[model samples]
Target: MLNKKAGMIAAVALSTSLLVTACSTQTGTESQASSPSETSKPAKQETLRILSGVVGGKTPEENALFEKEVERLTGIKVTIEKPAADYDKKLYAAIAAGEKYDLIYMGKGNMDVLVEQGALTQLNDKIKASKVLSDPKVIPTKEWDMITYNGGKIYSVFNKSEGGTLPTVRQDWMDKLKLQQPKTLDDFYQTLKAFKEKDPDGNGKDDTYGLSTAGLYDIQGFMSAAGVKYKYVMDANGKRSIPYATDAAVPIYEWFAKLYKEGILDPNFATNDSGKMRELFLTNRVGMVTYWDAWVGLFNNMKKTDDPKFVAKAIPGAVGPDGKVMLRRGDPSVWGIPVNAEHVDTAMKFLEFWQSDKGNILSTLGIEGTDYTVKDGKYSLTPDGISHGMDHGAPFPNNTNFKNPIGTLPGALEGRQIIFDNNATIENSTKDWPNAEKIVTNYAFQAMMGKMPAADAVKKMRDELKAVNLID
Candidate 1:
């Protein structure tokens, strides 16, 4: 099995591109046998319908090839339904109208809604009886625990957790400026100042900023550096309190204000999203960013065309005033089966096949030797594999079972290790809290931009939390 964090990165890559091959018209007529013992002999053919989200569109030819391969291996034909738009509404409406599906790919929140409505099946018995699916090795214990609810009834299975973002900087720019990676909060400030004033891009233009960030969430590293927590914290009396409302956040906001006032931070950061931030970095308008470690591949690929010398390096988040680094983890994405599906057994078998070694190879590496080669117990991609296998492997719609043997660049791997080492305090209590994240982002932006005083903003945030009964 791939490391959980690395598996998540590949899963996201696949989810964004989805299965882009064209839809297949060829139908399988063969039926399923009673067990794997009877798999060699032909039985009745069954077609399983799956509902999924549309991330990227695929060509008809590609879809046909994938469908054919799956049918050849599992003796089951599959149909994937992706709504053109309004996916959540359509998904629930279909279930409410009694439409049946073998599998459904959804967020955990949506899965919860379906489970409450009794639209999803309990997979405990089916999973236990499954030959391939019963193996706990395929899915991580933490992820399996996430999907198991209502006293151990399994309603869904999720992709691996993507882990946390780490602070990354332009190594080429740092080399140009003769600067080292920042170690402490003060060092970080000085580095950003140098990035702003020194024109690290070497274009002799005053168009660069020290940092490009979207919202308060992007500054989780800063909060860590300041020895402050944002989501929640334990009070002196042992009661839970919103950390954003406390004095600990004051230093963080003050630093943000300084960055904005000094022009080291992007002026439009109040409105910038991740795409905009990436645009800034890719276009050479910024020197540093905090993002998922997986993006190093994307940045490197894009820079190769524009500026081959451009290099990004990942560093563990800057050490805080208290000499500790903290980061938050991301939630897992999940998939489940419908209660009213016609072929429950067949659906479980498909899942089993998906997690099997052969299935993992097909989905992750495409055809072996053509897309990749294994030597000395290690896998290396061929030139063709680099173009197709990394970006165009078989799409595993609901599950990601393959280890990303190709892996990411060394800097990314190092950054991933740094995050693992430093992410000792995870503020995951707000994972399921509605509007908590948005409230924090809005208020933090206001404070950073000077639209409101930091103290006032904190008070208002506390009031909002009280209204929601999240804090007393």
Candidate 2:
């Protein structure tokens, strides 16, 4: 009986083995037969895992069109990972864990730290090899220099010719109030005062305020106008100083304190963020505020909602004590694909495709007829185009340090120039702002956080100022 059972089991096992072998052979044969002639078969394409910020402005249909073009150009499938607001945190954690991503869109303050850690690959060699990318006119060498690290190794590239936060006021308000655009410190204050007392919005209610800059060390817009360091201060002798300590920032705070005490500025301005400031402007509570050219939409929309005749316009570039203006020029951050990744070549090719002529046109003008139209050989926005601008904001004036031949939106390009001219006086005026590492080690940011007395904060700032020249 035992011999009979063993023989049965052996028979079953033999049958199972035969079945598996047959399946394997059949699968291999089918695979071989599936291949068509080289002329008829399509080439195999690679896939790139890309992580980008939320792309705005394009509708679902428009985005689909863009995706089709991108697929055709790169010959690679792009998997987009658009995380929520926690994009930076997730990216940081991923990088820390040595997880690989094909591309990453970095932001302002974080890019410096990432570069210092050697997380990014040097792109100078790669850039030089691409003739289409290396043309001097296509990518300005001076701008590319900013993205270089130690020993002139380029790790990243910035997009756009320029960007900044500018102080804009209602031109109609100025005309009604008979006020000149503020050119000096005193004029700035006076203009704000007139706006506060005179109801620039034409509402009989006494609800208007003079200035509406974001507060709590939010110094980009108005504070920069003082020719002081909004983030890092540099003295006449080339010493790095914290603006919180020296006359540069003291005057600004003093002005704020005075405004707060006198009820000329928004009482909550000390705590409000940019969003809140925008809300205030839309509600017609603010006469003048420091904002970006993108706010043109907010102004327009608010006018449409409130009163069509009420116009919100940009304030002329104000003059400083030295007869110069300081504009809050910002930089564009791009996606850098690390060279150590498994798909470096594929990733680079994808970037090249994104910057190509077809890519630029698609990115710059989302969905041709839907977003814009060509009239007399000039690109013009459709009636719905203004909505697209409101949605897309502005493409970085520079794309991967490449010159943007498409140019910027009318208001944005003009506003960017206003910032450049304002800060032009400081071009080479102060040496590079002390590196972030040095600034934090020397200066206690907690004081500026408003936890300590302003006087004590000033003292600590002065002490930290001594390290300004260490870089030189």
Candidate 3:
């Protein structure tokens, strides 16, 4: 019985081995016969992970069209991570943990910190090697110099901006009140007074104000009128002194006090931010404001819904009593690659593509027929584009610092040019002083509100600066 059982087991084992061999042979033959070309295709495309603060909180679905377009153009997939809050903290945390991000969008100050910590890679060689970045026409020499570090290493890309804010007024209101555009400080004051005393909006409720200022009340413009240099002013002896301690600042503050006391200035100026000030102008509560030139489009479009007759004009900053009108240059946003980036070459390639002409057109203009149309070299926005194109996740190479003369609104470029031409006398040296803006803003608010006398405020400001060893 045992011998019979052993023979049966041997036969079953042999049968199983033969069946396995037959199945393997058949599978191999089928695979070889079926399409070999499909099996020999290339690997999947590379994906780049970028961390940025300016993702504008777009969800995956909302960003689908942009993502698809970018991928189609660059042959690279992109994943953007935008922190809901505490962006800087989260960004630093990720860097500290050695987590890799192909690209990062950060301010100059933060970039400096990251560079100092060796968290960012120097891109001088990478930028030079790239065909797109090496072109002087694509990336200007001046912009390249701007991004170059003190050690002569290019660590980031600079976003160029048409700097300075323009003081804009309601042209329709000025027409109704029979007032010309204000050019001089006296003219500005009188215009504000008229706007306050007279109903510029014609609501007959005495609800409108002459001027609405948020935060610093735009004292920089006012100080320019007095020929006061920011940060430091030259004394009678030709020695530099803090601006707060200068004689020119006194008149400026006194003027602010007068405006505040006379109700020509918005009473809620202390707490109002840029958004609230914009709301005030759009709601027809204020006749004049100092803001970015781009806001003109926003104001016009918003007001057109209710009052098609509403027109806002960007006017030159008021000339000071000393005949000087200064405008400060604005700093642009920057993009940097981290040292631990898994795909540095891919990241560089993405930036090169972004600066390319095709990329610039796509980012700034969107799909031509769908968003805008060009006739005789003039670009006109489609109705749907005008309504929704402003923030529709379109690529904004210029917005992110890739240089292109696209995406500017009608009259905005001209207005910016006018401001640049007239603001030759503006000084921006005070920007280097740490906490100088905060000191000026605080003292200006106190002096304007009559909470502290202008002279006393200046004395207190100088004293505080001296205490902190910021001033002599």
Candidate 4:
């Protein structure tokens, strides 16, 4: 069949992309010395190759210009390539095949394995010695500590973690329904009830819900508002406990059960994927959904042409009954060099340059002339820039000193402040206790749907986790 043949060809192409000449001369890094006279020899035209799993969007010219900028600023030639699929397997395979990449883009999950195999170059001394790398502004001590393990040995550096979600809601609907923005958990409950009852979408048919998300956990902003922590917690004794199976989570389930009973929460929420959730939000079927801060601009970008009055805005998190507001962020993106990588000094220089102010702006804001332009001290983004999106090596840079000259998506700054102001936490995405997550989701859905009592659901969840030896 034509399809089968095409598949094989595609497979061959993917495999070919991973190939690299293992010889020292072909290591993709080379340095040439300048003329040395009585004055001095300024040496090294360092070239570094990066094998990345994080896919990016840039035309050949666009990327070339960025690469040019990087080299011009840091005196290093950088090249990057990413396969469109099967990244984790291909990355390990390439390393196994002796691919001498100067830098590798990987996730936190890959760190332990790479460290165990002695595949990554140790960064503890490198970080401590370098001016740019050692600065707390370039990377906070907390973030560096996250990557430090095996008796305080740091092997990798992480880009900035994505900010906590400041979920957007239908401001138009809230205005139409004569509802004020919700501040407290109770206020949120009432607002959702009004959205259900008042025909916020203004259609005669009763086809709207107050809020929806891809999964029960996707509505975690509200759960956080109700003072629930979903991730496992560690005690001083080094014992781990999942909060989802504890008393603290009971009220959150009960709250959702109330919403379900009142017909405020969407029935399909349990089954809906992210695409489905966004479709419902865009088409005016749901008034609220948990999403990132960037969705404010993105939702408008996607829906505004059809509906001129479409307005989506991120709001501050609701205060819980415990009188506390909280939000959770995720771990940062990790990158490291292989132990056998050539031009180690050059590679470190490039990375340090990336952590600088200028490099941070270039990565996040796109090119000056094309993605955006400034005139008379006023800056604005081009249409092409919005289309390109913030897809880059460090969309959220770890550098605390870096500021976006082009600004950011709506509510981004405020969202960062909210995280800073509130009792925020970052869930460890790497840790999982086998079937624990599936078990939690199952019991959570049932509890919110009112099929089982909250107490019973927690007990069942604990039992399931126990059966798998995830918890004792």
Top TM-score model: 4
After aligning candidate 3 to the native by TM-score, how far in Å is the CA of 123 from where it should be? 2.1
lDDT of 1 by residue, 1-472 (tens): 1111110111111122132223344544445645444333234566777776621113444455656667777777877676656566666676766677877767655666677777798988877776556665666455566567758998865532345566678889999889988887778889988989998888888989998786654577877776666566767785767677666787778778888889999898878778898899988899888776656655775576569889887776767666778765444455578888887877777777766766666555554555678999898877655555243322232233555666644355566567668863444343334456667767778888777888888778778877887675
TM-score of 1: 0.76
Compare the candidates by lDDT and give the number of the best one.
4
- Pairwise TM-score winner, candidates 2 and 4: 4
Question: Candidate 3, residues 1-472: lDDT per residue as tens digits?
Answer: 0000000011111111110111112222236567754443335566777776653224444345555666678878776666666666666667766677888877555665677778898988887887777777666666565456777898986433334566778888899989988877788899999988888877788888888877663545556677655555555675546765555688778887899999899999889978799899988899988776656765776667679889888777668665767754333456799988778888888887767765666545554566567898777777655665343322334433444333555445555675567653223232225465567668778988888999888888877776775565
What is the per-residue lDDT of model 2 for residues 237-273, given as tens digits with 9 covering 90 to 100? 8555445455456555556556666678787765677
RMSD of every prediction: 7.6, 13.6, 15.9, 6.8
Per-residue lDDT tens digits for candidate 4, residues 1-472, read 0000000011122343442322223233333553333233345457878876552336666766766666667767677666655676667777766777888877655665677677899988998899988988778877776678768998887655556665578888878777888987788898888878888878887888888877753566777665766656677786667777876788878888999998999898899877788899999898888766555656776676688677787776677667887776544457798998887887788778778886676667666777777899776778877766654556668888877776665545555666667776655433353356778889989999999999899999988787877665
lDDT for position 86 in model 3? 61
**Residue pairs with backbone overlap in model 4:** none
TM-score of each: 0.76, 0.75, 0.78, 0.80
Lowest summed lDDT across 10 adjacent residues in model 1 is found at: 1-10
For each candidate, what is the lDDT? 0.66, 0.56, 0.65, 0.71
Clashing pairs in 2: 159-398, 160-397, 160-398, 169-315
For candidate 4, which ten residues in a row score worst on lDDT? 1-10
Q: Clash number for model 3? A: 4
lDDT of 2 at 119: 74
> Which order, best to worst by TM-score?
4, 3, 1, 2
